[model samples]
Target: MNAPQVSPIGGLPSRGFAEPHQNKQQAAPKNDALVQIRCSKAAAKEVKRAAVEAEMTISEFMLVCFHAYMKR
Candidate 1:
């Protein structure tokens, strides 16, 4: 007996075996809402640093923080 091959991406089955969802189009959601924050130059720099440390974009970092706040 022989084992099937796998794709490096998504750990999905390869060799003509594809899931239905995998074939569907995936798009980024539209940004319909906006929130603005004002801060000093130092504060802005700190936010940038923190976002980088967390390996997320500035927008992602902000959303994560906002979600955490809402959960509390």
Candidate 2:
């Protein structure tokens, strides 16, 4: 009987992760529609500042906020 082989902790790929597919033209995004929210200049500046502080794009920040609101 052969001794059992030990697996690495993470079981990650040994040769490195596969590269992203090349030259695959992506279809136009279906969720590209924009829903504009009008706010004061100061409010907009604060939103931008918050997004920067959170290390996220403005769109990502807004989506996070939306999800949080929906959760509540």
Candidate 3:
């Protein structure tokens, strides 16, 4: 009787793809914190527009603005 062919490497089949964590979104940095701001709808819209124009997330734009204000 002919024996069935087997992989030389005996283990779980290798997935032809990246591991789950490799494809996952990066975890937030340890030093980062979430801050919520309360504002009127008009103010929110203005901030969103400014962030978009600056090509930054609102948090990044706000941090830049805060640093600038601190330097003044």
Candidate 4:
């Protein structure tokens, strides 16, 4: 038996993301406040729910959540 095949989405570049922590010399704001990270589907749903319950923007809720993590 042959393995199943998957087709690519049209006209997209390959390997869209780069290695992290490799471009410290790049231009960026000193107080940049946003970051992006990959999360599992379940984790993403939970974050959204928590943010809504806290009546916070996603960024604010994430900052609060992360601070709570660091405090532990």
Candidate 5:
């Protein structure tokens, strides 16, 4: 006979934990239009300054911020 498995957290069965997060994900809809954003002169300048501080290019800095902002 097989011994019952033990949990690492909350002592709950492992199978019970996985599905809760999966169920909360939103379904994607059709026809999603991306917003076109124009960076203002001040914002552009800020990105340039940040890039200089990080020893990177303005485009690279903007890419980093774009990814972080999209994630949020």
Candidate 6:
């Protein structure tokens, strides 16, 4: 006889879990705005590397930098 695989959080099988957020139309809040930035290839690569080092998404890192600039 084979035993069923269970989820780490509960006895329910992993496949039984429902991810409601996945079905949502929008991931971010309505008040949040989007901004686009264009940079040279070298600058883009440096930003990606810095974001990784800071353990943040590229967007998060950019927001942090922007806020710091605004405060100065």
Superposed by TM-score, candidate 1 places the C-alpha of residue 58 at a distance from the truth, in angstroms, of 4.8
| RMSD values, in order shown | 10.8, 10.1, 10.3, 16.0, 8.3, 10.5
Candidate 1: where is the Cα deviation over 4 Å?
A: 1-34, 68-72
Kindly provide the TM-score of model 4 when superposed on the true structure, using C-alpha atoms. 0.36
What shift in Å separates residue 63 of candidate 4 from its native position after superposition?
Answer: 2.4
Scored by CA lDDT, what does every candidate get? 0.74, 0.75, 0.73, 0.75, 0.73, 0.74
Q: Tell me how far the alpha carbon of residue 1 in candidate 5 is from the true structure, in angstroms, after superposition.
A: 54
Record all residue pairs in model 6 with backbone atoms less than 3 Å apart, i.e. clashing: none
Each model's TM-score, in the order given? Answer: 0.38, 0.38, 0.34, 0.36, 0.37, 0.36
Model 6 vs. true fold: TM? 0.36
Number of the top-ranking candidate, with TM-score as the measure: 2
Is candidate 1 or 3 superior in lDDT?
1
**Candidate 3 wrongly placed segments (more than 4 Å):** 1-35, 65-72
Candidate 1, residues 1-72, lDDT tens digits: the string is 999975578675555855667435465466787655567999879878878888997678878878865676
Worst 10 residues of 4 by lDDT: 20-29
lDDT by residue (tens digit), candidate 3, 10-54: 576876986567435466446566554567999879877878887
Residue pairs with backbone overlap in model 4: none
> On residues 1-67, what C-alpha lDDT tens digit does candidate 4 reach at each position?
9998767777557766776674665755487667556679999899788778879976787688788
- Best-to-worst order by TM-score is 2, 1, 5, 6, 4, 3
Task: Residues 41-72, candidate 5: write the lDDT tens digits.
Answer: 99879877878888987678768877967886
Residues forming the 10-long window of minimal summed lDDT in candidate 3: 22-31
Q: C-alpha displacement of 38 in model 2, angstroms?
A: 0.4
